[model samples]
Structures are given as structure tokens and as C-alpha cells.
Target: MNDFDALQAVIRRLAAERQAEQRACEAFLNALYHALRTASGPGLPLNNVTFDFTPDPAERLRPPPPGGWHAAWLRLGLCEVLVRVRRDEGAFVGEYGEGGTFHLTGVTEDDLILLARRLLRDVAAAYGGGGLVGRSGMPLN
Candidate 1:
């Protein structure tokens, strides 16, 4: 094969790999969403959560590089948290934090899910003992 042809082949292979990884990440995000909704454990399941794959408003001021930061906000009642995932050196790296203070790096979907559950439990412990209020200010059962 000519040099150009070899380069093209390499590019195609890399593209395919990137596409596969993207699909996996998408699947992971969807699974995480469902898991949070149906998650059963120490705290209440986050059935009323909202998720979006957009940059935080502050971060939007500066555009992210290719395959840079991908973030999802999990808004539960009056509580809000951020879940961010990105490709770093060909591996998946993730962070989840309450109120945008990301402090954990999760390498797998399961790890991220576990962190999310812990956040939910912490919120419940903090505000739900007396009564948890929904976004609309209605009491949560």
C-alpha cells in the first residue's frame, strides 16, 4: 500500500474505535440514568432526576477541546450535582460532585453509579429526615 493509503487505513481504524467507544459511553450514560431511577438501597431512588449532556454555563464560556468535557447534571429536588466524563489518554475518566465540586474520578460505569447513589443517600440524610421537599416545594413522601 502507498503511504497515503496506509495513513488512510490507520485513520479509518482509529475512527472506528472512537465510534465504538462513543457508543459504549452512550450506553453507560443511559444505563446510569435508569439505574438512578430504579436504584434501591440506603436512600430514595432518583426517579425525578433531570440529566443533560451539556457544558455547565460557566464552562460554556470557553469551548471544550475535541473529546474534552462531557457533563450531565443530576438535579434532584433542590439538590443538584454534576457528573462529568471524558476520554483521557485513550481511557475513560469520570468525575461526580455535589454542586459542581467534582472530587471523584470514576473509571467505570459501576463506579459512577455507586458514587451517585452515595450522593443521594447523603442528601436524604441531610434534608429528608424531617421532610424532603421537591423542586416545586411540595413534600416528598
Candidate 2:
């Protein structure tokens, strides 16, 4: 084919790949949200945490905030953590309060749970230390 046609084919391929990536990101975020929401048990740092999905999962068609295409907010007491899928890296970006930023890579539900647990630990550390407790009165530090 002509050079113009070749470029058009490349553009089409890139567009399709980007769209697939977006879908994958969305699925990943949704699964993560559910995993974190339902997680519970003694000694779990997330017991006192509040989780919220940006644009809500039902509103996926809506545009996302400038921070990321999709986000999960984890709030504990006064500390707030934001988790989002990085468009460029395709990894989960975890940001807590001011300067605590981390990247978590995972693809399965189990991986997401581990990622959430890790985020909670970091958030607890950022919040202060050793004061987080579950309903069972167990220390989570």
C-alpha cells in the first residue's frame, strides 16, 4: 500500500491498542474497588478505611478527574489515599496525603487485595503510627 495508507493502518492499530488498554484499566480499577470494599477480618488495616470510586463505577462513561482516568479513594481518619491506574505506566499509582507516592503492579483479584493491604500499611504509617485498630480492638500497626 501507499505510505499514507501505511500510516493510517498504524494509527488504527494504535487507537485500538489504546482502547484495549483503557478497558483493561477500567476492569482493573473496578476489581480493585470491589476487593477493597469487601475486605475484612481481624488485624486488617482497612477495617476503619472508607473507599469511594471516582465517577462511581456505574458512571464509567463520564470523564475522569485530571489526577487519573479512574481512582479509588481510601480515607482513614484524616489521612486520604488515592489509587489510580497510570495511563503511561499501566501500573497502579498510590498517593497518600502530601508526598507519599507508590506504584503497585498487579493483575488479579488476589493481587489487588495485596495491593490494597500494602496501601493501607503505607497510609497507616503516613497517618502516624500504631493506632489503627479493628472492631475486635486489635492493633493494626
Candidate 3:
């Protein structure tokens, strides 16, 4: 094949791979959302959770990079938790922190889920009840 043809072939393959990766990431996010909601029970305070798939403008012209970032937020009582995911050298890396005070990094999905569950449980215990009043002055149950 000519050089131009070879480059085109590479682009096609990259596009296909990027599409598949996006789909997989979406599926994983969906599963994680459901799991968090289920674990929350009664009222879902995570309604505002969203996923951003748009690539940065600078990165848009070329094929999608191998590693990128994914993030979501959760509110537990007055505490705000930031959950982040990224592809690091062919591996999935997860991290979570609360108000920038406490952070746990380099965790897997399972570990992150477990930590979230524990955080919820601990917050509930600390509040002496199951519901927590959020920053909006509303109880998140």
C-alpha cells in the first residue's frame, strides 16, 4: 500500500478503537451510577451526576489519545466527594477525595466503590441518622 493509504488505514483503526473505548466507558459509568443509586436507597442525591465525553479542542484534530480522564461528584451530607478515573499506561486508575481533605488514589473500581460505601456509612453514623443536610440546606436522604 502507498504511504497515504497506510495512514488512512491507521486512522480508520484508531477511530474504531476510540469508538469502542467510549462505549465501554459509557457502560462502566452507567453501571457505577446504578450501583451508587442502589446503595444510596430511598432518595438519590446523585441526580446531578454527569459524564463528559467531549475531547479537548486541541486533542480533537488527531485520533483520541490512549489515556484520558473521567470524573464525577457525589455529595454526602456537607461533604463533597470527587471521584476520578483515568487511563494510565494501559491501566485504569481511580481516585476519590472529600473536600480536598481526605484522598485515596491509585485504586481500582472495586476499591473506589468500597470506599464510597464506607464513606456513606461513616457519614450516616456521624450524623446520628441516615440523612445528611447538603449545602443547599436540604436533607439528602
Candidate 4:
């Protein structure tokens, strides 16, 4: 193709790719909402469900905010490996994992402290389901 034609072709291709990515992001987010829903007030449910996510335009289509609940889940999920329990619900649901459904119940002051401490080391890994889990035994620092 001529030089001008080649440049035009490249520009067209780039535009097409960007459009595809935008559509994909939208579809994926929509599907995600229909999959992991929150059932209760002011929190995401650990139960399998669906939810609608209205992304913020100012953030350039970034996903919803990572609230405190999500942060808590990262902590508990990491500790879960060492504790040997069921799958971490809060990770997906965005709320405090149900203590009744698992070992850690009764969100007491001490429990919160322990969870925060455990997650501190491995929060970066926690995002994509990868993270370090502290040992089960309390060594007494």
C-alpha cells in the first residue's frame, strides 16, 4: 500500500482495537454484576449472586470503589489458607465474611486487629487471588 494509505490503515486498526477493548470491558463488567451480587444492606454478600456496577466516568471507566469490606476480605482470605477453612466469601462479595459460615465470627476488636495485621504483609498479592498467608500459630511477638 502507499505510504499515506499505510498510515491510514494503521490508524484505523488502532481505533478498531480500542473500540473492541471498550466493548469487552463493558460486557465483562455486566456479566460480573450478574454473577457476584450483594444481598444485604451496606455490604456485599458472600453468597453467590449478582450486582450491577456503574463505573465512574471521571476515573476513566474504572471499576467500583474498593471499600473497607473488600480490604477485609483480602486479609481474611490470606489467613484462611493457614486457618484451613472454607473459601473466602468477602473476597468476592465485598463485605465482612460471615463468621457463622466460617471460623472467624463476632467481629470483635481483637479479631479486627489480627486480620489487619495478617493482611498487611500480602495485600498486594490479594488482588488477583495471590497473596502471602501468615502462619496459623500465634508466636506472641
Give the backbone clash total of model 1: 0
- Candidate 4 — which pairs collide? 33-51, 37-49, 37-50, 125-130
The per-model lDDT (C-alpha) reads: 0.58, 0.57, 0.51, 0.34
lDDT of 3 by residue, 14-76 (tens): 876666655554455455555555455446545544434333333444445445445555554
Ranking by lDDT: 1, 2, 3, 4
Sequence-dependent TM-score of model 4: 0.25
Question: Model 3, residue 13: displacement in angstroms?
Answer: 2.2
Pitting candidate 2 against candidate 3, the one with the higher lDDT is 2
The positional error of residue 73 in candidate 4, measured at the CA in angstroms, is 18
Evaluated with lDDT, which candidate comes out highest?
1
Q: Candidate 2's residue-wise lDDT over 24-107, tens digit each?
A: 666766676566654554355445556665643423533432233555666655665665564556565644334444465656
- Candidate 3: C-alpha lDDT: 0.51
Tens-digit lDDT track of model 4 for 69-135: 1111111222331111111332222122221112343344454344434433343345444534436
lDDT of 1 by residue, 16-114 (tens): 555665555555555566667756643666668777666644455233434555567767767766666656666555655532222334446566576
